[model samples]
Target: MVVGLREVAERAGVSVRTASNVANDFPHVAPETRRRVQAAIEELKYRPNTAARQLRRGRTEVISLVVPEISSPYFSELAAITVRVAAERGWTVHIDQTDGDADQERRMILGPAGRSVDGVLCSPWAVSPAELVELAAGPVVLLGERETDGVLDHVAIDNVRASREATLHLLARGDRVIGAIGAQPHLQNGTAELRVEGYRQALESAGLPFRTDLVMPVRSLHRPDGAAAVTRLLEVEPRVDAVFCFSDELALGALRTLLEQGRRVPQDVAVVGFDDIEDGRYSTPTLTTIAPDKTQIVRVALDRLAARIAGQTGSGAEAPLDLVVPHRLLIRESTTSVRTRKG
Candidate 1:
């Protein structure tokens, strides 16, 4: 037997509208009435018809979070945070994975999947700013670095700054001939490009020549891709002293490869990574990484999306917001307290 709003209203000795106001968290409800309605709801285990309520209120009470790959630890953790934050605000979240396909991402942005939700939070890798503008489905807040043309809400850290800091840390430890792994030159993603630019900037600042051979490109930011890139890096530049990976997943794979090849971490080669994922913390050597404030990112993105959903933008009165969350470089065993040798 399903308990409905009418039962709750009768038990609370209030009208249907009053019970609804309490259930929906309307500000006009009195404290005494709210207490009675809440007590009745608990006693009867009343579950509101969310779909119907949303329809009547002209909202869906649902948000969509789109990422490149749900299996990736960074993306999965982000999605989990998004779901938790949305739930706290009495909203539901739907997750979509695009597998880093441009057409698929475009479809997700413009197709039915994007239209079904009240708003969308996306971390697009392949979709361009022009494409987003032309095919926008609804209210959107981006989670990663993308050129949004000042029209879409974006929340991300300064990828270039963080990457530069990571590389400079490696350089400060007396490591030269540092190989950069996980460059996605083919994708032309802003994240990859920014990270690479940062790495080059650090090298340039340090008076180190940027060698094309030391930069290893990968098709995906996956474990196997990282391992393969590292393998090639070792094969060509066998004396490379350190590597700065663009992601923790890649760093883990690179660490594994180094271990398999009988190379001592931070002794023969130092390693650093971005996107301080959990796996990085527990890895054998404990990865040093750029840790973005994920909590703040989720909070800001949700707050902005909620505002947009409430029609707060108000007829193009305000410019779209681009929030750059703070990040820090965590120095772990992977790149600390080790003697550096010139390779």
Candidate 2:
């Protein structure tokens, strides 16, 4: 009961090769012939074998999206956008999670990707900077805060700027003694380091001295890590009035711990987070966060990848090697309107 390409061709009164060209969307078929084939396909309810079609073109039309953890809300939403966008262009996205493992990232970068996929979109955590240029010589584009050496095709917001903005928001709302959570001093990850730098910059600009006691290091950006780090922070710095978390997950966790410990959000301890995830919108006080434009990130990434696949590196149409997308600070109830106006 299956309607195959051969049947579709017969119904359209065209050769199988002609029908195939149409199905694969290869150019050069006469206009009338294309209409006939499309109509025949519709009438016969023909479904093309995508894999076989792509293989004939000497391409798989598949891309790998590598990330530290897809389970994270930020990454989950990003992967969803990537998959949806890739499908519109007749491509498939294979999501590969490394759990921030260096060895896994190394293997993925140096392993079967070249043979299996047309390109790669990665948000790397543990890969060394030296390996970044090598990653770019292939069709690899990074998705997050990484020191790409201007050689790799990278896409990310300015992490330092975003973090500074988040901190300044809390400060503007009359909250001082802010604790910074999610500093990964133990890892080679540039994201946490950049965020901490931004937090420090904001404090410095506010005439607040950088305090080592207020900067909390975390093993991960998960809720539990946030909960534990904030707990320890609260125990030591009982007067901490605000916290700028590196991720919404951490912020949510910190929010929970603060409320449980008798601190009211905004009134007592304002919270700001990055990665404006959906949960933030529905949290108790609703979270304030830095929202990166995920759809734009995926579109730009895929566009760059397509250019790379076509060997369009030197073409003037190619985008910048290090592209920065747009992000906005979304304010919510978690941060009250400036409790005290600042100059």
Candidate 3:
């Protein structure tokens, strides 16, 4: 009782080739004809067999999403959104995690598995842009970072702007002697560089000197890194009034360290972080952080991959394809007053 392509083509008054063209979204088909074929296919509930389609088209009809750390809520949330979006377009998502390891990332890009996917959407923590560009044999979409040379479709927030805005928010509240938890080479994608630029810009704008000692570079994007970074920052500049963490996880770690050190948040020292994560909202004292449209970013990323898989191309075609979403400050209890009163 299954419907076939020939039945749908017959109902639409089109040849099998014409129906195939409509399904593949081949250009040059008349709009009216395309509409009729689409309508007939929908009415017949004709689900194209992926294996048959692949055999005919020489494609797997699969898009791969490569991330550095799947365990991180940020990446996992993004993956979830990407899957949902791809599913809507009759596409499937293949998720691969590299655990932020460079060798694993290299293998993913250079290995045969990379070639099996029709398109790729990735957040490279260990792979360099140059290497990514070389490894990409097909359409590649880079997320969570800036696009280099229009190498492929990209969807991201401006890290520099987001970081600067977060720093400025703290500065606006009269915070001086600001501290920042930075990332070392252990992390990826020049994130630390861009964020540091933002922090420096904020300080420059406020006529405050950029103190190198106040920046503590951490080895990872975990709570332990935050804790260790805080310890170093306090020891280097014990009287620091504010701290900006590169991520919410680090901020949580810093929060734990501050509590253990008997320093009250927003009282002894104010703290702010990037990535307005779920845990940040429900922390002991809610975390003040920068918020980006994560869901929207993922949605756009998946749509771009789908389009690329369907052979769509060029800038500003079919949709606003390349995206750099805006970021906003979400103030919370963690970053309140700039000054504390001694009783």
Candidate 4:
């Protein structure tokens, strides 16, 4: 006998719609009710009719997850959670890497124009805000911030605040003459800009003057880029006692270079990074960094995308949904010993 949602609902003692909501991984379901529905589903061995549902809804039930580089530890971790969350929803995800290319990002953003993909979840690097508004075809959810003025949904932590907190931590521990790595002034995504802004905010709040030479802009947020930037900072600002890197990859690279240049971690120079990747935890001195709740970020973005796919339209539909998730600064062995503040 062919099993359907009705049987599951009956077993779970919930309405068919409630069972469907649970099956679809739609938010707002009570935890206990959802548990019962899921239990019933397992007991009945009910497999959802994805194809039939797709045909009825005219949806491919697939979304494109575009990122600059999937190999980047931060993006890789983020993508892993995204895939898992999307799978629970009975949806498929197509991973596309643009490598922060302008043309590639443009294609991913506009590719879903009545195409196979139902929506797009993109962490764009090069696409401008004007281009995004103009090129957006279907329900597109940005994985980062863009200051798009209600033209897009932003699922991210407050980059400025996170960056500022990390910087302030180092300052509180008596590390002065701190330098920041990772500023992409040429990009309009605003992620890099926001992080740098936070760094500057922390510096200003501590009565330290921001210097053009102390902030380094990078072509990319990778190990080598971080290494090169730190080398430059050391050369330009020889008295640099600490550094704030924008990404764990950069921080790792900075740590390597700092070691190569005969600087000791936290003893001579304290370092902090963002995006708490796994490698940071095992590095020689370990990395002090910011940890964003990746699971929350993925789930919220997918939930909003599902609503959009369901044709969310109303007076407030055009308003931007900027959800700021939680983030915390993790102090690790990299800053185990605070550098003595010079009198």
Please name the candidate that would achieve the greatest lDDT relative to the true structure. Answer: 4
Task: Return the TM-score for each candidate structure.
Answer: 0.87, 0.85, 0.79, 0.81
lDDT of each model, Cα atoms only? 0.87, 0.86, 0.82, 0.88
Q: How close is candidate 1 to the true structure, as a TM-score?
A: 0.87
Instruction: Itemize residue pairs with steric clashes in candidate 1.
Output: none
Ranking by TM-score: 1, 2, 4, 3
lDDT of 2: 0.86
Residue-level lDDT of model 1, residues 159-210, one tens digit each, is 8899899999999999998999988877735788888889999999999999
Q: What TM-score would candidate 4 get against the native? A: 0.81
Q: Which whole-number lDDT from 0 to 100 does residue 241 have in model 3?
A: 90
For 1-343, candidate 2 gives per-residue lDDT tens digits of: 8788999999999999999889878899999999999999999889977666667766778888888899999999999999999999989888889889988887776564765788888888887655754644358888877666766778888888998999999888878799999998877758898899999999999999899889999999999999999999998899998988999999999999998988888788899988999999999888999998899999988998888888844655454488888899999988974334345
Counting clashing residue pairs in each candidate, in order, gives 0, 0, 0, 0
RMSD of each: 3.9, 4.6, 6.2, 7.5
Sorted by lDDT (best first), the order is 4, 1, 2, 3
Per-residue lDDT value at 110 in model 2: 55
C-alpha lDDT of candidate 1 relative to the true structure? 0.87
Q: What is the lDDT of candidate 4?
A: 0.88
For model 1, the superposed segments whose C-alpha errors exceed 4 Å read 1-45, 111-115, 338-343
After superposing candidate 4, which stretches have Cα over 4 Å from the reference? 1-56, 312-316, 337-343
lDDT per residue as tens, model 3, 62-94: 788888888887788778888888877766788
2 versus 4: better TM-score goes to: 2
Q: Tens digits of per-residue lDDT for model 4 on 131-227?
A: 7868877888887664656678878898999999999999998988999999989887889889988988999999999887899999999999999
Number of the top-ranking candidate, with TM-score as the measure: 1
